[model samples]
Target: MTDPSRRRVVVGVDGSTESRTALRLAVDEARYRNCLLQIVRSVEMYEENPESEELDSAVAFVRDDLGFTEVSGLVTSGFPAMALLEQAADAELVVVGSRPRSAIASVVLGSVGSAVATHAPCPVIVARTSGERATPGARVVVGVDGSDVSERAVDFAFGEASHRGTGLVAVHCWQVDHPAAARWDAEAFATRRNEHLRWMSESLAGFQDKYPEVQVTTSLLEGRPAVLLTELSRGAGLVVVGSRGRGGLVGMLLGSVSQSLLHHAYCSIAVVRPVVPSS
Candidate 1:
């Protein structure tokens, strides 16, 4: 088990533009946290030796550019996702660049980012390459749905906000199904919405109490969870969500909100997974 007192951050590099951005972000984060930075590069079976050479150059560039004196580099041979997940075992946070290919062609969260986020022993950050800048006073946003997994996500978001000295926002989205021919009932809908907002406020009270220093905001929206989260992420420095929730098969891989937000969210996203229930 990783000691909570020790500071360690792991970042994956793949010689892409996105990967370079991730390296920079990782270095900055390490400096901010005063932690040891570990650069991990993975090589698949079909890749040639030149990939390793490129990785070496990339590592040197990161070290020189970031001026990080305490850094470690590792080159491993295996599936990229699996190797990174294994390395994340002892890390406080795992950072990876968003895939370079188109969203349709690319594996959304199925690649290194998604795989590690789902299975890693720690929080995983998926850094996007859209050239979005994190505003100085930007808050960290987290989605909550009253599930155990969401509670874990709330814990991570609170910890991160405290660590970064930023504000935290908790968002809950609700949807009310209606028949195709049914008329909209504005009054009744408003009453139900108010109740949901109250519930959300109560549910997030613990997080606010735990991190009193961190500013907290609670929002209740009427729409799809993923859509609301994507919209909220526009002004956030980081958005966090749970991997699996109170949905279908508990043993299934990734949850729906995590899968959708991973592909569509604008800013960096952290997908938190609960500890697997013991048999």
Candidate 2:
């Protein structure tokens, strides 16, 4: 196991505009986590691997210009995804950059960012918001459905809110039969909504107690999970979600429902994975 004191926040940088964005976020993340920052640049093994001016210069800039001397850089002989996973074996988090249009599409098409997010040992944040960048005070939104995976997501969301000192939005969405398919009375309809709301509230009660300082808003809406979540988090800095959900906002990071928000949400998204245990 890696030494706990040497915890690192890793990012893949290839001198692209997106990679630069990832590097910047990684720098802030490392500082926030009080850990080291690592930037990995990958080149094919068959290529001339030695003496990359790009990597050297980028590293120099991160160290000198950025005033982040605790940052380190690595040039590896492999695909970028493989390099990121190798470095993230013991990392606290791995950050990858992508444009909003390409964020999850690249993942579906088996891009490096998707590959790393799916397989990274730690949480992976794709720094692609519809906006120019994420703001510090923006609330952190989380999608929940009361499943074990969503529970884990809530755990991470609470920690994020507590640390960032931002409000947390926990959204749970469910749809009754379509209006055309079922005719219901106002009282019955209201009763069903109340049941769902109560359950959603209970799902978050434990987290609420644990993070008393985190102001949380529970969104129990009757609509498509992805649509509601996307609209709710329009102004959020980061929308966190479980890799899978219990028929809620996120089904699978690569699934249709999750892809909707991945396609439209205007904020950075963090795909939280199961915490990797230390040996």
Candidate 3:
């Protein structure tokens, strides 16, 4: 368990452009949240080095360029995902970069990002690019499916929107019977759309009330959830979603949409898992 009193943000560094971008964002987030910053370097078994220049440079960037007072750096040995999860056990958020350099790199990095997002105890931000900037009131989009898992994502989205003083777009996507069938039965399509809108409204009602200052908009669309959300992410500053939903398999940790966005989303993504109540 993480220390209860200390709040920290951890960033995994691997000397890639994505990792550097993740480090910068972690610094900005830590500064905004007024928390300590931790830079974690993951090394394979035979390549572990105490005097790694990349690690040193990352720490230097925080201390010199950013002027973060409480910065800690660690060199952990193992797979990057497992090392990060253990090192950031007490962190408020774990930040990682997700751009792949090659096909094999894509498979490797994708697995790392997906594993950490699915199993991490806290929130995980997968930074895909170096130039994503959010103004004071930019839009933050979240996917909702009216499940307990999605409710947690809604809560995270609301809190983020409230903190940034931005608007929240809650998207609920449903499939139509068929395009040809819908063309024939306009009334049936209308009824189905209305039902989805109603469910979306009810799912977001509490969040709207809690964060009254946040401008809330609901989108009910007919398409694949992943494609729609990825399209919406283009105009959004951040995309948030639950690890799984109603359609997820009983034994799977991540749903298709969440997993898909982790790799394809242009903007930063947050994969929020359902909160497990402490025993």
Candidate 4:
């Protein structure tokens, strides 16, 4: 059981390099937010000593390395996704690692990071195993698609930007009909792209009005959404996206674009979902 009054951040660790990276990042975030850090390791019910001594060693390393004062480690027996989702119910944020599936897996079989990001009750951070830059301040980037999810993403991005006192960049992307035209009509596309940029600006106007202190910029590109988003993520400290888009099943697993971005995006990605109304 979790205490509702205490702020908590849950992170899943499985000993993978990506998972280790996520654990380190989670520790830093937990320390910065002054929140309790809950480390969860899930294993099959049949496995003996579920989270073996090795897992304990890793948790100890995180505690010693990050100097985190408030930390708890738990070993649970269940499916990874289910265990994480249950743990996330009381968390302010949940962090997980991205694992690429083999070629035999279905195209829709997104990494566990994507699945948890799509279904967790709280905000999910999908951390990749990339080297960190010694940047002073974090950058917040939000993906916009004119849907409720996108709106939530915008809200999360702005809120984070305000919290971190960093810049917020709103990005939208579209596919080009002709490959040649994509290069030839760069200037013409700029004008059309401005329209989309304007739309994003208008969509996020309320957030701007609410958080007047946050600096924000918008970009619209004519290309594959995932590709463009991943490219923009290179310089961002945090990238935000909705669990699903306009075409996805609401309140379900992550949609295509969100799923794709989780694995390939350069920065730490936050997946936001709409608030479910109580019955």
Candidate 5:
């Protein structure tokens, strides 16, 4: 049973290498936040020793090997994505792993990672590699597009940066199709570029004030948002983006840029949805 008194970090465990990676990250994060790590696995309940064996060993690994005492695990019955979502309702964060997909899906988030990232109640971190760990004082990057969802992402990024004692890179990317346009419509292009820079500044100003210790930097680039962020992810400890963005149509849950980063980011990616208030 989940102890409601203790804050929890939820993770999906499938006894795969990727799941083990997710478990490691969850343990690290839960320890950092002083929260409980709840590892949940989905099974039909009739499976024999290997399933039980894996779960038992995973628990022991967390307790005896990892030395995290506040660890508990359970086997629930349902599909992987749905079961994980049900377990994550009260969790502070949901962590999941992504396997390398085929060439096409490689450019987008995998099926399970996509579903959970879009619908999880809280922020979701999609772990891409088994060994990419955020080092001390590493940088967290977030893309802002002047939307409500982007605002939430910025807030989450600031908090994460502060928690990790790292810096925040707030990136805003704008596109100019041709170099000739810059030479031909110089003033217009300059004005538009200035506008983008101002928007990035305004978006980060309040966060900077609130998280005074988190060193914040701004990246205003004239390129595709997804491409720029992908390049930026090479040096980032974590890359964050909104579930849906200014380019997405109404009611769309995930944006193209966010989806792209989930597949291509070098480090962990956090997909944050805007909180909806209750009635």
Candidate 6:
């Protein structure tokens, strides 16, 4: 049994392929953080409920097969996202999986992953399984735009990099809105790149001392931030980006850049929202 006082990694599973992937990643996260793992499956009213056997088997796999000691499971009644949000109010991290879908399916079926990432009080990771970025040198890549939420993302990314004993890559993108309107100057381009490099380094200033073991690098690319990040994700163990907290319909509709990365990034994506004061 996990202590109630300890901050835990919470993951919701529904016996789907996506949830299973989320569970595995959650286990690894729990192990590294030295915290509890709470596996939850919510059975909404009038809907067919998941078998308790599946939850038991998952808990067993973590304890017996995976040999992770600090783990537990719960089967509750409610909307899946609401149930998860309630449990994750004080969690260290809340994880959910993105549905594998075509572009249209993504719009039609608003993502639970996206929902939780937006409204959860803590940072949320929309975990996915990809082998391309799981190499020995794989780094935790973070998008840095200097927003408060992006700074929080930098903190989460540095912690993740330290936990994995890996490197970190801070990526920032700057592009001229319209090429035709602006005259292209190579010298000006170099100066802009150098400025972004310094800005990225400044973003890491606070966290570098906290995680000195992590080898960090900055990538200042000239392109769309979303597109560059998606391409970078192909070689990173994890890609972390920031999303602002907005309630209601606006919250449900993910921002354009995050929407693009969530759908196209090759590695697991973590959408971190800054922690807001309750008072």
Which prediction has the highest lDDT against the true structure?
A: 5
Clashing pairs in 6: none
Candidate 3 global Cα RMSD: 3.4
Q: What digit string (tens of lDDT, one per residue) describes model 3 on residues 60-94? A: 98889888767878887778899888866788888
Model 5: per-residue Cα lDDT over 1-279, one tens digit each = 556698888988878877887888889889777788888877765366577677778888898988987888777766778888897788888999876433554644456788899788788998766234556677999998898889999999998888888889999887776778786998988888898888778878888899899999898887788889988887577899998888665345778898888877778889988766676
lDDT scores in order: 0.79, 0.76, 0.81, 0.77, 0.81, 0.78
| Winner on TM-score (3 vs 4) | 3
True-vs-predicted CA distance for residue 220, candidate 3, Å = 0.7
Kindly indicate the candidate among 2 and 4 with the higher lDDT: 4
TM for every model, in the order presented, reads 0.83, 0.83, 0.85, 0.79, 0.87, 0.87
Residue pairs with clashing backbones, model 5:
none
Model 4, stretches more than 4 Å misplaced? 1-4, 32-34, 45-52, 99-111, 131-138, 163-165, 174-194
Q: Worst ten-residue run, lDDT, model 5?
A: 100-109
Which regions in candidate 5 have their CA more than 4 angstroms from the true location? 1-3, 44-48, 100-109, 130-136, 176-181, 247-251, 277-279
Give the TM-score comparing model 2 with the true structure, all chains together. 0.83
Give per-residue lDDT, candidate 2, residue 263: 54
Cα misplacement distance, residue 51 of candidate 4 (Å): 3.0
The TM-score that candidate 5 achieves is 0.87
- Model 1 residue pairs with clashes: none
RMSD of each: 3.6, 3.9, 3.4, 4.2, 2.9, 3.3
lDDT of 2 by residue, 1-279 (tens): 324478999988777777787787788888878888888888876355543767887788888878888877678887889989998888989998876544445453237877776777678888773544556688999988767667887888888888888999888888777664335577767778899889988888888999999999988877888778877766787888876665433323454445565556677778776544456
lDDT of 6 by residue, 93-139 (tens): 89897664344535622457767876887778887655353687589
Question: Which stretches of candidate 1 lie above 4 Å from their native place?
Answer: 1-7, 31-34, 45-53, 99-110, 131-134, 177-187, 248-251
Candidates 5 and 6: which is better by lDDT?
5
